[model samples]
Target: MIFLRNILFYPAFYLGSVFFVLASVVSIPIGPAPLRWSVAAWSRFHRTCLRWLLGIKIEVEGQLSREPVFYAVRHESFFEAIDAPAMYDTPVTFAKHELSIIPGWGRAAKAYGMIFVERDQGAKALRKMVSAAREYSQEGRPLVIYPEGTRTPHGEAGKLQAGFAGLYKLIGLPVVPVAVNSGPMYHRFWKRPGTITYRIGETIPPGLPRAEIEARVIAAINALN
Candidate 1:
């Protein structure tokens, strides 16, 4: 049953994504809000599909802060990335710089307020990221970053990427580490029926030493492991 459902869902998901991407492109002239709405709508559609078609449910633990802060989320699968808009209001997600080079989707992401990071540029990239983060933080938008940089298999706790610590220090906002175990369930073609929980850990205030902040974030985000 799950296999059959997945077979039916894959095409629908891709088709729906293409439709929304085009919607985002058309909304470009309308402004960033409309483009963001299009993306959020896509997220909502996927969440609804997951519940109804795949029998997968979401269970969030702990409170999400209303104050603008850096959200250091564990990277488990693409599921958590798409689920961001559904979970937060106008989140500024940190994405790879390469994603911004894509044709229509890239333009939409920039207009919709994603922060692109040039990882290989070292110091220059860090400065750019800090500037972008500060701007968004001032605008009362929560910044979401996958500290592991890329998706890791479920139950694995990889080292936090180099950029996370720098962003934590320079952004000057509290860090909210979020652990999720969605990979085992949603990473595969045939997703299993279960609850994918976003376990929000305690908020670590800014201004802590580098060692302290890194330790706290790593431990907190890997709590589920």
Candidate 2:
């Protein structure tokens, strides 16, 4: 049954994504609000597919802040990335610079307020990221970033990427670390039925020393492990 469902889901999900991407292209010129809404609708559609087709459900713990802040999330799978805008209202998410160049989807992501980072570009990239983050903060949008930089396998706790600490300090917003155990269930081609939980940890205020803040974020985001 699971195998059959997975087979059905792959085509439906991809085809639905293409439709959403095309819809985003038409909405892009209208501005960020429309683009963001279209993306959120896509995320919700994905959630529905996960629930009905795969028997996978999402359970979020703790409160999401009303004020704008930074969210450093565990990178377990692509599930969290697509689900983010649905989790937070019009969040400013970070994606690789390469993804931002991917024709139609890339242009829509830019219009929808995603920040692309070129890790190899060093200080210059950090400057651009900070500038964009500040602009989003002013607009009352939370910034979501994957601190580990890439997906890690289940049970593995990877080091936070180099740019995270710098971005945290430079952006100067309160940080919320979110721990998610979505890898074991959602990362595979043939997924299992289970609840994927987002365990939101306490918000760490900005301006602590680098070591202290980094330590706090690392511990918090890995809390479930």
lDDT of 2 by residue, 51-102 (tens): 9988999999999999999999998889989899789988999999899888
Local distance difference test, per candidate? 0.88, 0.90
Specify the highest-lDDT model's number. Answer: 2
Regions of model 1 farther than 4 Å from truth: none
- TM-score for predicted model 1 compared with the true structure: 0.96
At residue 126, candidate 1 shows an lDDT of: 91
Per-residue accuracy of model 1 over 108-193 as CA lDDT, tens digit each: 88888899988789999899889988998899999999988988887887988877887887888999999888887898767887
Stretches off by above 4 angstroms in model 2 are none
TM-scores of all candidate predictions against the true structure: 0.96, 0.97
Model 1 root mean square deviation, Cα atoms = 1.2
